[model samples]
Target: MGDHDINEDHAQASDAPPRAGDGPRTAQAKGAVSRWTRRVHKIYIICFHRGFAAFLVLPLVLALVFVAQKNHFGADQCKARESGCGFVGNEDAYGLGIRLGVYLQWLSVFLVVYLLPSEERSLMTSLITFSSALMMAILVLTFGGTCTYTVEIIVLLWTAFMTQALASITHTAQEIDDAGIREVPVISGLKRATTFQLNLDSPQGMHGFQSGSTLVEMCILGYAAWFWVCLLRGAEMVFAATPCGTSLFFFARIQDRKGIVVISALMTAVSLATLLFRLAAWIFRTSVKRWFSKRTYDMLGAVLVSIVYLPITLIAGITYLVPDTWMLKMFPGSGGREQLMVFLCAFVAFIVSVAGIELLLVWNGISDVYGVGSTGQLIPLTMGLVSLMPILWKLLRRYMAGEPLVPEPASNGSGLLIRGTALPHQGSPVEMAARQSDREALQLP
Candidate 1:
């Protein structure tokens, strides 16, 4: 009996299928899955907080501006040994039209990135890019402006469209159930209708949860108004000085003074409207206090990173990491890295505060740090310097006040939203409370 039983058991063991994790192929498959999961996690992290990350492109924008300074195309500042070539003032209105256009471009980008989330975010960003591209395309066709930013805008537009298409695949939402609280899915796809409505929609009206905000958005709104007013006045000067803009609006080939004022006024109206929306957004941000706290620091850090490092990274990647046919045309020089390096050195000097060195060394001395072949081609050198003053001033003020360089984001880690159908085991009171909050966050109506 014993011998037959032992023989039967050995036979059953031999006949059993190999375990899932035992073979080389299984190991390889597991490894591949792990790698893919990690890659996805990385992408989500990088893309999710892109508003703060937008500062990374600041250097690229600067590259577009100062590329003209590397050649003979720039103004008197190009001729000076010190390179902070503020706009050549030879043009009417100290070139305020150009100034207005450039600052608006930066603000437009910041708003799109900062205001929205996921597919909605990308769509808005793409819409803004499309409008700018259309305007720039017309301007280039008629008169002239930098094509590099146009190309960048188009690329971003395409990326946003692609992101919109893939949003469902990348993002996932979980359901939160509060025992009796997870009663019913009231409004189909909307958040759940709970017994007691969540405070997220209404007011919390307490400052304890929020950190130092200074209502920076409101401050920026006021600043934008002042800036646009100056720009409008400057536009008036240019329009009075030259009638080309308004004439072109009506398709008249000859230069006409009336057209410039009309065109400038139209642009002023659009700029004011844009600022109004931004103001509304900032007001909305006050309600989401914890989510939007430390906004100024985020803005400052992003700007500094863009100003300090983006050019070097873009150039290196353009040269070594990606194909370079378009970059060569966009940058018009191989010497950009050197200029960027020099700028870095100057920044370092400013940091050390060596021997009573003036800010002119850092502020007005960064021109001619980019283009190599831009002698008579697309020179945006002058207004480029002016465009950054608003952001830089904001950052420097924050710096002097001893505020944080890199802002710490508020944690919204509490919540009980489970991703799937599995029920949770018994846990402590704190754990149960966290789970309940998670469901409340989902608020599945």
Candidate 2:
């Protein structure tokens, strides 16, 4: 009777219910959710595959067919003309148009990569940046048009937008986590938490190819797309004079008469200044990228550089494109002419100033990254050297080509001075002076 009672009690207790913190039941629920998520992931992958194939392959095939049909040549036509006929050919712009389309295509790809659920985004960003860089290089080398540059600018802007969106999402998710919150609290908080944790573990939260991505996350990811767009447009204004005939169709802004006059002048100046500064940065290897965390400095520097680039480009562009007669009319003949010269001088001065800013930015980057003092010490030399190299190199090369070398003001490190002698070629006076200056710079305490 006692044994029977004991057995019945044990069965009843087991049948009553499972207690809280039952590991097996929780594990089973997790397993089921994992299966469902996996299925969803598979479907997403398939969708992406289809989209890529349709968008990329189909368009490529159609483009090839269209080009062939439009540009076909007749075999008998050449024989008819003893002298080769200057047959009507396709516009170079058409080719540029195709290239522009390709760039936009890549931009679209980046958008998808950036917008996809987080787990797959890292791989996508790596593929996107690398691929786009190659395409950009190709466009730069071959097409070399304002249209090409415009596309490049657009792509960069798109990248900024994508980055900001990712950052915003990441920040929001983090905030949610800190609040011990679920995105959909009503739909099983534990499951949502588990899924979120899974996303964090995946590439969705971390990118592999990006440098100082943590800093990037802190810097760029939390920002909005509009801010990035403004910066990109500002940067684009630096080289605003170049004809982007078709690109205007895509990205141009209409202006009132007074506004047009003002904007044109501003853009031209900014563009010229930015271009000169970029040249200086390249020559000196005084990249802001070297001094600071690539992500942080790039984001911050981007803002300042863009602001400077915009107004300058507008001025230069206006000066170049506007009728000289009209420009001369705007200010009285003597005063306007003087103002024109002043504008040119100011643009040049701006370039020199920004070159200094760029060098300082570089030094800051180096200090931040490597704890190196070399950058700080070399800052002034880098600034002066970079600004001078382009003007000197261009002039020297021109002189070598037997072109008349018009003298421009070269800095004596004390003040701007007229050259007493021509700039050197193969150990010329200027070369010797530069070497001596460099030596003195290197010896600085």
Candidate 1 whole-model C-alpha lDDT, 0 to 1 = 0.29
Tens digits of per-residue lDDT, candidate 2, 1-445, equal 1234323422432322344666896765565444433333332222221221222233333432344223323334323321221121112221223223323333333222212112223333433333344333332422232222232333333333232333322222222222221112212323422443323333322211121222232222112122223233444331221221212111233323344444434444543343333333332222344677746743654454446446544564465565658765553332343246334544454344334322322322211221223333233234323433444564466467554343222322111122123323455676445434322321212
**Candidate 1, residue 340: lDDT:** 34
Error of 2 at 104 (Å): 10
> What TM-score number comes out for model 2?
0.21
The per-model lDDT (C-alpha) reads: 0.29, 0.32
Over the stretch 234-263, how does candidate 1's per-residue lDDT look in tens digits?
432211111112112222332344554464
RMSD of each: 23.3, 30.8
